[model samples]
Target: MEKNEKNEEEEADEEFEEDYEIKILHGYENNYYDISKPFFIYSKENLVNFEILDSILPMNTSKNEHKSGIIECRYQLSCFLRLTRDVTEVTNNLNIQQFKYILMTLKFLKAVENKNITKLLQVLIFNNFFYQKDYKLRNYNLHLIQILNSSFFTQIDFHLKKNIMSSFLNSLMIRYDFYDENLIIFKNSKELFDYSMFSEHIPYKNLMINNFDAFCSVENILRDSNVLIIFQILLKEINIKSLILNNFFRHLNPDENFAFLISKIEIFKAFTISNYKIPASPFFLFCLIVSINNNIEYLRLENISYCRLNLRGLLEGKKLKGLILSKIGLTENASLINESRNVYETIEYIDIQGVFLNHSIWHEIFQSTNSSKIILHFNNSDIEEIFINNLKKFEIQKNSVLYLEIKFNSNTLPRGFCNSLIHFKNLKTLKLDGYIIYEDTESLLYKAIYYMKELECLVLCQNCRNTKPYIFLLQNSKIDCLDIQSTSNNNDAIMIEFFRLHKSMTRISIKDAKVSSLCLKEIFKQKNLIHLCLDIDILPPQVDQESLTFKSKNIHNLDLCNNTLKYIEGVDILSKLYRVHTLRISKCNPPPGYLSKLNKKCNSYVKILTYEYGILDFDDLNRIGKLGNLLKLNLLGCKFSGCSFFDLVTSCKFFKSLKTINLLNSNIKMKDFQCMKRFKKLKRAVFSFTEFNLLTLKNSLASLQICKLKFHTMLEDSNYNEFCLYLNESNIYILRG
Candidate 1:
C-alpha cells in the first residue's frame, strides 16, 4: 500500500512538473506565437489538460469515493493546484491562449462552485476581458454565466462601477439561453433587487428575459417616462410575444400621458386606415404599422392605389420631410395645393407616381420648396402638355430641387418634356426610366443633355423598340454615368460612334444592344471609361476582332452577358486596360483556348473572372489557374461536374491572393471542398445545394478564419440543428445554411 502511495505521489509530481513546464513555456513564447496560426494546436494541446483536470475534480459523494479515497483526493487536489498555477501563469503571459485559458478556467471554476463561489467571481464574470490577440475570447461571457448560478452573485451595484460597465452592458446585449437555465437565474436575480440594473438591461430585453422577474424589470424600464420616447416606440414595433406583452403591461406604470397617448393611438388601426385609400392589404398594413411605430422615414408608395390625399387639414403641419405618392390617381387639380403651400418648405422628398400634375400645380410645387428632391412618374399622363406648361416654372426654380426622376412608359418622350428638361440646369441625378426620346426630339434631348452639364448620373432604359434616340442621347450627353439598356437591334454603329465621341464616360451599360467591331475599336480608344457592360447579339464578325487587337485597357468591370461570340481573340487588347479587375462572361460560347490564353496573358492583374449560364469544363479550370492574381472566381449555373474543378482549385497555390470562391448552383460535392484550406488568404466562400452538408463545410472552414462565409441548401432534409451548432462553434460571420 505504501509502495503504491509512493508511486501515485511520484506520478502526481511528474504531472505537476509537466504542467509547470507547459505554463512556463507558454509564458516565455507568448510574445512570439502568431495569432494567424490555426487554433487546432492550442485546442488539442492546452484544452486536453483542462478536460483531464475537470474529470479528476470532485463535486459530490459517490460509490467510487471509498474504493480510491486517499489517492483520488490527493490526485484531485494536486490537479486543482496545477490548474490554478497554470491559469495564473497564463493570465500573466497575456496572450490569446492565456486569455482562453483564463476564460476556460473561470467556466470550470464557476461550474464546480455553483451556488458556492464568492461574489468577486461574478463581478469578474461581468467585466470586459480582452484577449488583445484573440477576438474569439470576447464571446466567452455566456459560457461563464452558464456555469455560475445566481447564488454565487453578490448585491453589488453594477452601475456604480464604470471600469468595465460598458463591456458588461455589451455582454448583456447577447442571447445566452441554451440548454442551461443559469443565465435566466442571473437575469432574474438582477431584476429582483436593483431597479438601476433595469436601465442597463432594458435596451437588450430580447437578450435576457428567460426568467420571471427579468421581464418585470424590463417593463419598469419601459415605464420610465423620463427615458427617450423613441425606446417605447421601438419596443412596440418589435414583435414581442403575447406573454412578454402581458408581463410588460403588468409592471408598466406611466406618470405622464405620453405613453398612454401612444397606447391609445391604435397604431395598427392608424396604419390600416391610412393605407385604406391606398389599396394596401392587411399584411402590408401591418408592415406599415411596424415601420411607423419604429419611426422609419423612408417609405415607398409604389403601386399603391392612392387617390387624392385629404390634405386640406395637412396645411397645419410644419415638418413634412418625406412624402411618397406613387401610382396614385390624383388628378391635375388634386387637393394638394393647400398641403403643398403649407409643408412644401419643410418637405425634402416628394414622389409623384402616375399623377397628373397640371401647370398650376407644378407652378405651386416649384414655387413652394427651395431644396426638395422630386421624383415624378408620368407613366400614363399627357406628359407633353404638362412639360410645355411647367418648363418655365421649373426653370425659374432650378435652385429649389437637387434630384429629379422622370419615368415614362411610352417608347417616345414628348418633345415638350425633352425641351423642358433643358431648363433645369441644377439637376444632379436624372433617371429617364423608359425610352422616351423620339427621333424628332433628338435635338431637344441633346440640348437638354448640354443644359444639364451639372448632371452626375443619367439612367436611360431602352424600353423603346427603336434604339436611334438612345444612341443620340449617349453620344451627346456629358453625364458621368450612362446606364442605357437598348431594346432595339442594329444600333452597333451608333453605339460605337457614341463612345468614340464621349471618351470620359465613367459607367456605361448597353444590355441587349449590338456593338460592331468599329464600336469596340472606338470604345478601346477611350481608356478613361471605368465600368463597361456590352450585351451584343454578335461580335462584329472578324472586323471587331482586329479592332480588339489595339484595345485600350482602362476598364475595371467588364460584364459581357448574353452576347453572341463564337470565339474571343485579341485578348491582347485587355493588356492595355491595366486597371481591369472584374471580367464576366455569361451565356456565351467562346473558342476552346480563348479564356486560357487570356489568363496566361493577364497573369497577376486579373482579380475576378466569372462564367455563368454556360459550359465550363475541366479545360476552363486549367485555364483559370494561369491568372496568378485571381482573387474571386464565381462559377454559378455552369456545367462543370466531378472532382476536376476541385483539383484545379486546390492545385492553384499561386492563387494565394484568392479571397472569395463562389460555386453556387454548380455540380460540386462536400468532398470537393476538402482542399480549400490550402488557400491561406481565403476570406469568403459560398456553397449551395443540399449535397454539401453545412456542418461538414463549417467544420472544414473553421480553421480558415473566413470573414464572410455563406452556406445555402435546397433540401428540406438539411440538418439545420447541426449547421447552427457548427456555426456557433466556428466564428464565421454569415451563416445562411
Candidate 2:
C-alpha cells in the first residue's frame, strides 16, 4: 500500500513539471508579442467570419472549452488567432496559408522565452527552415513574427536602439539578398540604416540631416570636463556638412575653444557671429588667421588674443584683404602676418601694437605685401631675419608706398639691416631710435642709401653708434632735413668725412659729439649747410695748436656750447660767416682778449655766451659787456670771486636782447641775482643745481619780471611739507632728483 501511494505522488509531480515548463515558455514568448491585435480587432468588425472557424473545431468540444483551450495553448497563438479573425473580417483579408503560418509562428515563439531557447530560435529563424524563399514551406513574415515575439526581441530594443538596429539590419542585408533586402529594409525603417554597414548591400547612401538638439547635445557632451570619450564617438559619427559642423562648434564654451580645433579647419566662418572668448593657447591668433587656406576676406575675429602661431605654411596662399589684428601679444613670429605669396595684392593696411613678433616674420610680411602703410610699435631686444627680408621687399615697392613707421628697442642695428637699406628707392622720411647693429654691416648700408634716390627727410634722434660710418658714407645720398642728436660715438673722423662728402647737405648737426679741431675743419668744408649744431667738448685737441676758422658764409645758426677757448684770436676768421644769425657759446674759458675780439667780430649778429664751471674773471665779463648784439647769456657752473661779473653784465646795453639766462652751479649768491632783472627781454631764467639758499633765491627772483623761472635744488635735505607747498604754489613743471 506504501509503494503504490508513493508511485501515485511521483506521477502527479511529473505531470505538474511538464505543465510548468509549457507555461514558462508561453510567458516568455508573450513578453515579445506585439499587441496590435486589439487595433485590428476593433477596425474589422464587418469582415468577421465565425463560419470559417466552425469547421475547424473538434467534435464534442464545448464553446467554453474551445475558447479556454485555445487561449491556454500559448499567449502568442491566441494573439495570432485573434489577429487572423480580425484580418478576415477586414475587406483585404490575409490568405489561409498566411494565417495558418502566423498561428504556427505564434506557437513556436511560446517555447523561445528562455534566453537559451531564444538564441536557438534566432538561429532557426536564419536557417533553411524559416529563412528559405520557397512559399510552400518557409514564410519570411511568419519567421519575422516568431523572432519578434521571443524574449530576445526585448533585449534587442534595449541594446540596439536606432544605431545598432541600423547596423544589424545593414549587416544582414549585405550578407543575404544584398541589393533587394537592403532597399526593402531601408525603405521600411530608415532609423535602422547604417551606411558603413550597408556598403556592400546597397549603393545608395543613407544620410540623416543633423537635428539642432542633437548638435547641442554633442557640443555639451564635449564641453564637459570628462567627456572626451563621448566627444570622440560623436566626432566619428558626425557628418561633414558645413552647417551641421558649425552648429556643433557654436555651443562650445569660450575657454574650451583651444588651438587644437583652429589647427584643423583653419577657417571659422562663425567667428564673427559668436563672441567666444578664446583659450589661452601659446600659439598666436594672427598666425592661425593668416594660415587658413580658405578665402578670409570677410573673416571678422575682433578680440582674439594669443601668443604665437606657426605661419610657415601660410606663405603660399592668395593675399588677404583688410586683415586687422591689434593689441595682441605675439611672440617669435609676429611678422608672419605680412608674409604671403600674393600679399601685396591682398593686404592694404595693418596696425600691430604691443606684439612680440620675430623679425623674420616681419621680413616676410613686408616682402610679400609691399604694404603702403604699416605701424609696428615693438619693444624687443632680439633682431630677426624678417627685418632684412622686409627691407628688401620694401625696396622693391618703394616707388608706390607712402608711410612706414617702426619703433623698436635695441643696443645696435641688426646684422645685414644696414646693407639692406639700399633697397629704399623712394623712401621720403625715416625715423629710427635705439637700434643696435653690427659694425661690419655698416659698409653694406651705403647700398641702401644710394638706391634711395628720393629720400627727403631723415631723423636720427637717439643712439646712432654702430652705423655712424655708414651714415658718413651716405653723405651724397639725397636728404633735405637732417636731425642728429645724442650720438655718443668716437667717430669724429667719419663726421668730418660726411661733411666733406655732402657739401650740398643743407642741415647738419654735431650736438653732444666729441669733436676736436680736426672735426671743426671738416665742418668748414660744408658751404651750403643751413642748420649747424656744434655743441661739443671743444677743448683743443692735445696735439694741435693751429687756429680753427669757419670760412663758410652760408651758416645760419651755430651752437658752440661746452668749448674751451681762452683767446678770441680765431674770431677774425669766423666774422666771415655773416649768414650766421644765431650763435651760442657756453661753458667756455675765454680770456679778456678772446672775449673782446669775439664781441668786436660778432657785433652785427645775435651772440649768446654761457660761462660755466671755469675761471671767466671780471676782465672776461667786461670784454663780453662790449658785445652790443648779445641775445642770451648763461653762466652755469662758474666760479666767481666777487659781484663784479654780474655788475659788468647788467651794465651792458646789449644784454636787453637776452631771452634766457641760466646761472646753474655758478658761485653767485642769491642776493646777487637781483642784477638780472635789468634785462627787459629775459623770458626764462634758470638757477638749477646751485648752492644758493632757496628762500633767498626765491625772494630775489620774485621781484624780477620773467615769463618762466626754473629752480632745480637738491631736495634730499629739504622739508617735504615745504617742498610740496612750494611745488603747489609755483605753477611750474618741476622734476626733482
TM-score computed on alpha carbons, candidate 2 = 0.40
What lDDT is obtained when candidate 2 is compared to the true structure?
Answer: 0.44
TM-scores for all candidates: the values are 0.48, 0.40
Tell me the lDDT of model 1 at 122: 26
Please report, as a residue range, the 10-residue window in candidate 2 with the lowest summed lDDT: 240-249
Per-residue lDDT over 141-235 for candidate 1, one digit per residue giving the tens place of the 0 to 100 score? 34333222122121112221221222333333421221111122124211221112222111222222333234334444345332223232322
lDDT by residue for model 2 (184-301), tens = 1211111111223222211222222122233333333334322333222222232211111111122334454333332233222112211223354323334444444464332222
The best candidate in terms of lDDT: 1
Global lDDT for candidate 1?
0.48
Residue runs of model 2 more than 4 Å from their true location after superposition: 1-396, 400-408, 415-420, 428-433, 454-502, 510-522, 534-548, 561-582, 586-596, 599-614, 619-633, 641-645, 652-660, 676-685, 688-727, 730-737
